[model samples]
Target: MSEGFNEASGSIIVRDLIQVIHEQRAYLSEIDGAIGDGDHGINMDKGFTLTARRMEGQLLGMSESLKLLGDILVEEIGGSMGPLYGTFFKKMARVSKGIGVVDGRVLEQMLESAYQGILTIGDARVGDKTMVDTLDPALQALKLANSAGRGFSDALDAMVEGAHAGWQSTKDMIARVGRASRLGERSRGTLDAGATSCYLIIKTLAQSMKELSK
Candidate 1:
């Protein structure tokens, strides 16, 4: 059987995600400034920082930690990001609630749930130059890799690659949703802030999963 990571120790993955968001907070804001209200990173950092504080000294399992983060994002944060990311993590938590190990199949299921959850909350589509662009591709890649019998680490690598490519693809897309959509063709030159953040989150998760699998 393929190797998997213990769900009990997977809280570290959430910690790593928080660290990356904190580190890239300013950069994410910069990306948002180009076409958004310029508060994407700031809001994200605030919520994630709060999550970190709330989790301090606590050793929760992956599902529990995800639930905490999701609840905080939905309750404490404002703007569209709050609900969007909250649903994302919450759906993931639901999928992984009782799993002993997070193997490729479990990870794929988690990604699918998160992706679908986001879709249910918004009207964004693949070419809409939204976070869906990054998330959809990543989920598809992971699903493909898992179905093909690839190792968990390799499937994660594929997921990261898909996310990065999707993120990059947003730079040349005319925004079809969000405030950036108001820019019309002018939005084509800048990267979508949501897509960029989605890419970073997926990349961090993939990296953490790879290490845990090792």
Candidate 2:
């Protein structure tokens, strides 16, 4: 869980976002190798790399960076994940609007927006063993915490727990969606590759926040 959003302007820089996005590909690759195409990592890295190249030196504000990144992801990234993730970041960027920085409440909102996009685009619900598993519950929990007026740190803590719980739920899910679904019952014991990657990437983001706190 992260503490209240730091009002500091550099809460997250554009360069760091690109770096993290590229790094996420490596993380995805590692996870996917266990049960899926193993290219999830490569796909994400390419997406972010393309995004970085397109932006060049133009990423001044949070909105500008994210908006440009979103279009690049949707247009350039060559997978189902591209549109889903593109939609997610786009929604986050939209929620951010012009705010240079946001509090934890907005963080929760951004996550929910992404989750909704995945739901609409992927047409998958819970038990489908997609990234939705990792995001849906996290956003739901965050919404609850936000309504309760919990501190930003406490709310984010709940989100972490929700994320992990969702990640775990994937193990029992028979892959009803994605390429893994072709294996049918064979996919039951293993976690959804996409879900696992989502968990890892989100965990990395949380870890980054923790480091920022220090």
Write down the lDDT of every candidate, Cα atoms only.
Answer: 0.92, 0.72
lDDT of 1 by residue, 5-54 (tens): 99988998889989999999999999999999899999999999999999
- For candidate 2, list the clashing residue pairs, or say none: none
Error of 1 at 118 (Å): 0.6
Q: How close is candidate 1 to the true structure, as a TM-score?
A: 0.98
Q: Candidate 1's error at 138, in angstroms? A: 0.5
How well is each residue in 7-83 modelled by candidate 2, as lDDT tens digits? 33432544465686576666767667656788887887787777677667553555566667778779888588789
Q: How close is every model to the real structure, measured as TM-score?
A: 0.98, 0.84
The reply for model 2, stretches above 4 Å from the true place, is: 1-17, 24-27, 207-214
Residues forming the 10-long window of minimal summed lDDT in candidate 2: 4-13
Model 1 regions lying over 4 Å from their true place: none
Instruction: Quote the positional error of residue 146 for candidate 2 in Å.
Output: 1.7
